[model samples]
Target: MAALRSREASGVPLAWLIEAVTAGFVDADVSTLLDEREERTARAALPPSFFGWLAAEARVAQAIVSDQNEGDSRVPYREVERAAARMLLEFAYRLMHDDPDRHFLDLPFRFAAPAARLGIESSLVIQAVRVTERRWVDQLLTAAGERAGDIAHSVLSASAAIYDAVVDSFVTDYVVAQAQLDGEMLATKRALIDALLKPGVRDAKGFDDLGIDLSGHHVAVVLWHPTAGIGPHLDTAARQIGMSAFANAVTVVPGDDRTLWIWLTFADDPPPAVLERVRSIPRDPGRVGVAIGPVARGVQGFRRSHLLAREYAAVAGRLPPGIAPDIADTERMSYLSLLLRDPERAEWFVATELGALATGAVSDRENRETLRLYLETGQSLADTAERLRIHRNTVVYRLKRIEQAIGRPIASRRHELYAAALLAHLLEQSES
Candidate 1:
């Protein structure tokens, strides 16, 4: 029966098949889903590595059931936490069958033992499962595309049983495991972070315990590296930030193996030396990525600055390695990051705004630099020419070329032109 269902899924209409073949639909759905409150809650609970891990697990489960292979797929199980996750996912996939083999029913028990030892909270486990279920439903519906409305009910109906069984069994086992270990610290951190990030009243005592003064100015910084073993490096960088500012900073792991959330607090706005220290953090080994948010004051500022840091981090992740630091606190990046939340949209905007110059050829890049400098210097031809060490006629000539490519007078769409050119430069840098 499972085999028949799997075949039916694969043998869908051509359009459906086309949509299903690429993971882009799933990626898009996941991105959209992350914007929701519940998804954000779950995202906050897990580490930055969770999304990539979940995607890999989904692929492995799909491979197992579709191929009817009891043996493990190629996904790595080096981490015990992920090994437990894989087992539970496999059990869920099996339950989709009319007569699932009962042997794998003990999977929840297996997951509980290690989870308890690792001090994993039951609520977090449930939230993770719930988020995964959401993704699964979205993947099915997205693959259906135009037929999504037709199959949405059926997909939800079929997934309900699997989700319920998994949750019930997990909660039951987790209750038993909780008696054996204390995960109170993890729970406390999770609650504190939720309160800090979410909209509502906050407990001042919580901040007091962490030595964070809510009334002080804060500059949020997010540091992450591709590899998991960079925790020590991140710690060193965080300390350096505090030292450079001659102030205190609070750092949170946020449950991610590869990321750190930090807020450096000051009695006043950070001075030039502190900003310079932040800009130099990327020079550290391990290729650590740093995103520094603007300095702001009080509780609201703390939250807002962290949010901005997350946004900056998102934009930085897309840039080529060597240039991420150069964009930190740059006037152009601050302006462009606000508008480039969606990469696809950014690409389209760039393509439309800078027709010929967007091609990223040598001549195109030279013209983009000329235009950027020209705008940066208040549209002064002399200043731009001097910056480029070229004749003023050369600057004017390049402006004419830019105007021709954008099909408008530069002054008419100066803001759009500047944004598009800057973003295009970064995008091209990333491509390299």
Candidate 2:
């Protein structure tokens, strides 16, 4: 890049190039130079005929960027054309003046802003500047006939310097513009994600624009590291899990430090223990926290899975050390998880709903335990008694006491209630 800018022939001073760059730029009149060069070489490079052609044919340059903007739905053809025309004219002027930063306030010279706005990546825009400049040089050379050969070397040198300088400026501006757009886009995506977390908050057109789809089966995983950056690690984990488990995955940061919310999408329920693949990555130091939600379908399922994944993290926090489970099969402890989700609220509900049995009385505990066992054993007195190591009459007596304590006859409808209560008790037991 520096070599291109350093190329200067006789009559063109290198110091002037640096000075021109330092002092800003002035638009160069190229047709006037062509007229002078033509006087020396007795050529007609800037003939009346060529000027007439440029008046009409310069519009062709506008289509160049459109060809480069592949698969971009937001291609702004009119703005791109306006910018390209200006860029071509800017190139023509730079060829004469040797001022790289000439036409500073013009739309043609400000190519990078339009490129970035039209969904062009910075790297690609830099390449576009290089390619477009070379093409412009080619057209200029063809336009300037062989009779102008005396000054062709000088013209090429000036063009190369212009090309290098224009490319450098375009690249710098493109990167800065891209960063600003990317920041704005990131904030927009974050807002959309927050909105998408709610039920019935999706817009198909909006999601399509952002390329986010929740209308699929999703298994969500929550991961966090106490120390170290997490995006790269989570990215590695997502890739590993997706490849090994044969599912496509999307990740969301959810604005937590070193935490990642990953959702793996599948045609059906995801494979069992899918996160084990994430845990198996070579970088796995076992320092990262992981919790997984069960597979479910559609938008509701996607939101529910994330909610459950977060809920699993909550449950894990309350669990004892050295037993930080890898998977949080929300399906397994779902009944209990409902209680564990908010211990205080569950406790209040239990106390109010279960009355005396919710108190920790020995006989009440015995009756509640026997009733939980009886229901779990399919109302089998023998099975409940054997599990409790007491006679069938003892099971019957406990059932009567449970019915009285709860102020309701023990029936199929009451099973869900008692099961939730039993799960709460069992979760409490883990604390001991």
lDDT of each: 0.63, 0.60
Candidate 2 residue runs with Cα over 4 Å from true position = 1-57, 67-74, 85-128, 139-153, 176-186, 199-215, 228-231, 242-245, 248-253, 273-279, 285-287, 317-321, 327-432
lDDT of 1 by residue, 181-251 (tens): 44555566656766887876444556554567878888888877755644677778777766666666655
After TM-score superposition, the amount by which residue 370's alpha carbon in candidate 1 deviates from its true location, in angstroms, is 3.7
Which of the numbered candidates is closest to the native, going by highest lDDT?
1
Candidate 2 least-lDDT 10 residues: 38-47
TM for every model, in the order presented, reads 0.49, 0.56
Compose the digit string of candidate 2's lDDT tens values, residues 156-254.
675676666657667778888888987887677777667778777543445553454567688887776646656677667656655766676565554
* For every candidate, C-alpha RMSD to the true structure in Å: 24.6, 10.2
Question: 10, model 2: CA deviation in Å?
Answer: 14
What's the residue-level lDDT of 95 in candidate 2?
A: 52
lDDT of 2 at 112: 71
